[model samples]
Target: MATFCQFAFFIAFGSLVSVHADMKLDCQQDFVSLVWTETRPQVDTSQYRLGNCFPTSVTATQAIFKVELNACKFRKLVTGDLLQYSNNLTYVSSELELLPFSLPVTCVYQRPKDWYPMIYNPVFDTYGQGELLFHIGIMNNDFTGPAESSSFPLGSLIPIMASVQQASHQPLQLFIEECVAATTPQLSPNGDKYTIITNKGCLVDSKVSRSRFIPRQKSSEILGFLQAFRFSTGEQVYVHCTLVAWDPVGLDKTKKACNYVQGHGWELVDNPSYNSLCDCCESSCNARKIRSTPLGNEMVHEVVLGPIMISEFSDSLF
Candidate 1:
């Protein structure tokens, strides 16, 4: 069944599972990472042998997907050999009924006729708030020739497989990876709020935003990041200064109309700091911990603090 979402849009999770809540599923942004994997080198693919193949126009992006094993089943397939090709033919049949999300693919032949493996990176778009769950799987269906007359050495299992012609005889495994980047305020299970820090992303930020595509709030020192900032008694208020327009030179955003902010107020300072860390919605922002990867370190000059609530009684204390 299709899930009716906001704006009358619908989403279908072919596998009845929730998107993982631990992975960071950013909004309107794409990241590099393979969140799931399942592979088996040994399998009897005959069970799934419907002995049929489809017009190869299928792809990972398509709404409905089925695995085509003709390309991978044969270790060495001679060209134009239909008998040998059909002998090696493997496809989805009753073996796939148990899959979710049409068996998500990480690798597949780029073309129906081509044998090269193409890297699969699917881009998911949704306005749904909260953790996103994803379900994906892979299967092996190599149904070719007779079991008893096989040339390869497998004396231990020759008698048992004498009757089972074309049946998949391998167990299936499924893996799930979730992202909480869409959760409310992007909260983690351990209570950490994740925020996107512009072109530099979470690790970095630019003095100016390069592309308005991955949009985020622009802040100013005039908005009070250097010193003590106060907030209302008990409300989690998300705030950003209202920008009347941008400067002609850098397209630098400027908040000229303090009166127009509508009680959100405004600030002006001689020393301006483009510090996103110091720009939370409460009394105090969380301290960012940095770690280095083999490629690079966390590029940052300072841990900017913001209007983040330090405690439940932050307003009462200050």
Candidate 2:
């Protein structure tokens, strides 16, 4: 065993974090991660992402920790997190569940190949926490080359589906970005109609997996499958195939972008409300339709093949 040294880290907000027995405060590593293989105590890690990749795999260390309590018999997972702050030592953690036993967190550290400078400074240190961050799979953006995006005229309904996964194989409607307390969707006998809309804007579509009494063993594919929605009432839309981590608990939905501040403090920053506004990275190539006239007032039937737009799937999706 590597002989460990104990150190106290002081937070500006009158707090101290003693290094955990299994954790080391080091900065020279190329990569550092916290992981485990326990299945029951974890929630959908496939859709879970931070920065550019999912952490639980061989390349990343981010994991979605979930715990089940015997008292109430409920499932919960954390959502919003500021993985790193201004320094190599600062890290943020949300509440998680791992029934019968506490979550086994293993920290792995490696030297970096090439990364931007890191510091830990907060803009508003009073909140004791920074902004909320959402993530998706890294493969969604790993390659380059104009991927297809679809465009749609006004009054078009686009197909949308959200998969709240619990593991690599289990499928459920419980999506966790920041585990506060999430309510399950009320469904009919066959899981057909939802009483308490899980994902708003999407109407009830046909179920692809099993019936209500038994959902598809918690898979990663589809969480809440619904058909189509229109973001705006006016103006045509251009959208790309995107994945998003939706945080239901947010002070301001617009402020979802994450950026590092000074030292050990990464702050949740906001994209400027002008030019190209960036929401959570759902539509990878989500470009806003700026001040432009509708295409010549003549309705064109030809579907232009360019990028994956929400409008392209305005009809069918597999």
Candidate 3:
């Protein structure tokens, strides 16, 4: 009886070992089902065939994303086994939308040897009491791209001037003088006029008050001035003192005025006549004449004004 019982015990132990081995082999050869889950509570099940020697379980590298293998059934799944999957991707934050505005005025000054482009910044200053002078400058040689015309506020020319003064490195004196001495006027084909007037005429007075006169103050004059220049979007034109004198308040005009003028067919100057100042008339000055190039397409419209001086003595005084 004892021998028979021992034999039965051995047989039972062998059977148990065989079953364990079979289960391990099956697990290694079986296809795994992967389940993907998200915070939204939706889950997707996919099947993936595992390597014959794959381990029973494994941990995922990312905490937010997890991979699971389902090995409950041996049937070939239509969607295949759910393989390693992740659903814990981070969502990106939304950005605020901004409105588009017209491009800013681009100013280019070209000498015979080199050229420099700058963005025009309109500035204002209060000498005392209610006295104000609107000063605009090309603060830097930043020629990244075309500037937004709306970047400077039309009604805030004085404020823009003040802002420029505040941001200047030097202590801006309330009594500043204009630089360019001569400007010549030109008429646009579409009837929009503009002139480049030098500060030579303006510097005659000791304390010339500078203010941006709106069209309402002088409508016909302003209209006449604007009608003189031809503005092109892609062509580069020289912004001489002539144009500045014609429309010193160009910086103060409304968007409607600019758009209207532009729509009227103001185009870029291709072969701009530089004889307005007669500076290029001299044989030595021929080297300094403005030339048109393929890059002229980058030229932009800008209004620049300066202090007044006598035209005859502009070369010396300015």
Q: How badly does each model clash, as a count of residue pairs?
A: 27, 56, 58
lDDT tens digits, residues 57-134, model 1?
A: 322221111333333332211112111111112234344542212222222111224322222111211011122221
Q: Which is the better candidate, 1 or 2, if ranked by lDDT?
A: 2
- For 227-249, candidate 3 gives per-residue lDDT tens digits of 11122322222233211211111
Which number leads on TM-score? Answer: 2
Q: Please give the TM-score that candidate 2 achieves against the real structure.
A: 0.19
lDDT assessment of candidate 2 = 0.24
Which ranges of candidate 2 are over 4 A from the true structure? Answer: 1-35, 38-318
TM-score of each: 0.14, 0.19, 0.15
**Alpha-carbon local distance difference test for all models:** 0.19, 0.24, 0.19
- Per-residue CA lDDT of model 2 for 52-73, tens digit only, reads 3334352132343222121112
